[model samples]
Target: MNIVLTVLEVTAPVFLLAAVGFIWVKMGFEYRVQFVTRLAMTLSVPCLIFVSLMQTDIAPQALTALSLASIAAYVLVTVLCFVLVLLAKLDRRTYLAPLIMGNTGNLGLPLALFAFGDVGLGYAVVVFAVMAIYSFTFGVWMVSGGGSVIKVVKEPMVGATVLGAIFLWQGWETPRFLTNTLDLIGQIAIPIMLITLGVAVARLHPGRLGRAVWLSVIKAGICAAAAWGVGIWFELDQIALAVLVLQVSTPVAVTSYLLAEKYGADADAVAGLVVISTLLSIITIPVLLIFLM
Candidate 1:
């Protein structure tokens, strides 16, 4: 009962608010979505990263464990997807990004924080940092058609991660007032992101949902299996292992849509995957917690 309630409490507001945004967009308030997305991507997200990093005290051992676990999970998922593509005879362009990139930053971070509090949030930060790097570089190369490597170097997330790392390494602390202000700003990110997602869903045509659902199920199932097996092999703690599993089991990231749009990799299909996978995670995540937690 507690777990179910927690899930409802955490997700219901975001989903409902996003649904409202969707209805508004359907009623022709498209401009509002643009404003929300811009706010989320620029001000709220960066502040969230800075504030989260600054507030967390990440020990060297924790950092090392997180890095190793994250990299291992990433590599395992990548290889699993590659094999799936070959065996399933999937279109290389369509499956590449969505299969490998889970919703680590937006959905996973918030969920981890909700489940395990500050320590989980710290672990999530490390995971997000690594995932962001992979998404920008290798992810772009996979989805984009002959784009220059320079595009990856110029990503805002990359810069934000770098700046956050520098602050962490320097052991810099924000003034309490500024920290509070950033916290307030950062708190807006999750809800806004969910609402923007709802708007994005409103924009999605029903015709594209079938293939997306199929791809999402495959991605989620395979990734979950890989995460579980790896967690056992590594002897990870319950909380850490559960976090990794939940992160991996998340839907194909929204970034997959952006990548598909920019690089000509079946954008509609990718968008469908993102939406379907995310919705399905409402089921898959709790199921994971039932055992892992």
Candidate 2:
């Protein structure tokens, strides 16, 4: 009973903030999604990642273990999803990327912080970084048939991740004032991301929702199972294991839809995956938290 309350306590704010965005959009408010997304990705999210990694108390060794575990888990998910897409006779360009990439940033980060505190956020950052890079490069390539390594290199988040990892390894810290400023900026990332998620979903026009529903179910299962198996094999500690599973099992990201729209690969279908997967996460996330907790 207490666990149920705890799970709800952790998740309510996330969905509620998202609901705020949804309602705002429904009420016809001015919410500039492109500007908001750019701000979060280019500035706030990188700060969050760097600060979290810099201030984390988790051992460097444990973080490295989790990083490798994350890469392995994603690899497994990709293979499984590829097979699923092929067998289902779905358009690879439209379905595969959404199946592989999850909303680790908006939903997963907040859930980790609420569920397991600072340590969990730190661990979640590592997984998010891995997924972000992979999504930027390989995931993009899958959809567009051509990904630029230079584009990946230019991403602010990737730069932040590399710098943060270096700092963590070297046990370095910035000046206190700078740290506080970055922390303040980083604080906005969670709420901004959550609200932005709602806005994006509200604004999207999804198609093939029936197909998306079943695919979302399959994605959640595959991601959670893959992460769980890899986490155990890698002997990640309790928090690390939980965070990995949660991050990897998050709903399909809105970015996947954006990428599809940009690259002209069934944007409506990808949007369906994003919306349905996100809605499905409301139930799936709490259930996983209950088990993980």
Query: Which segments of model 1 are wrong by more than 4 Å?
Result: 32-35, 146-149, 166-171, 206-208
lDDT value, residue 258 of candidate 1: 72
- Model 2: ten consecutive residues of lowest lDDT: 144-153
Can you write out model 1's per-residue Cα lDDT over 54-92, one digit (the tens) per residue? 667765455667678878988999998999888878788
Worst 10 residues of 1 by lDDT: 144-153
Q: Considering only N, C-alpha and C atoms within 3 Å, which residue pairs clash in candidate 2?
A: none
lDDT by residue (223-263, candidate 2, tens digit) is 99999999999999999999999999999999999999999
RMSD of 2: 0.7
Q: Candidate 2: where is the Cα deviation over 4 Å?
A: none
TM-score of 1: 0.87
Clashes of 1: 0
Model 1, position 175: C-alpha lDDT score: 89
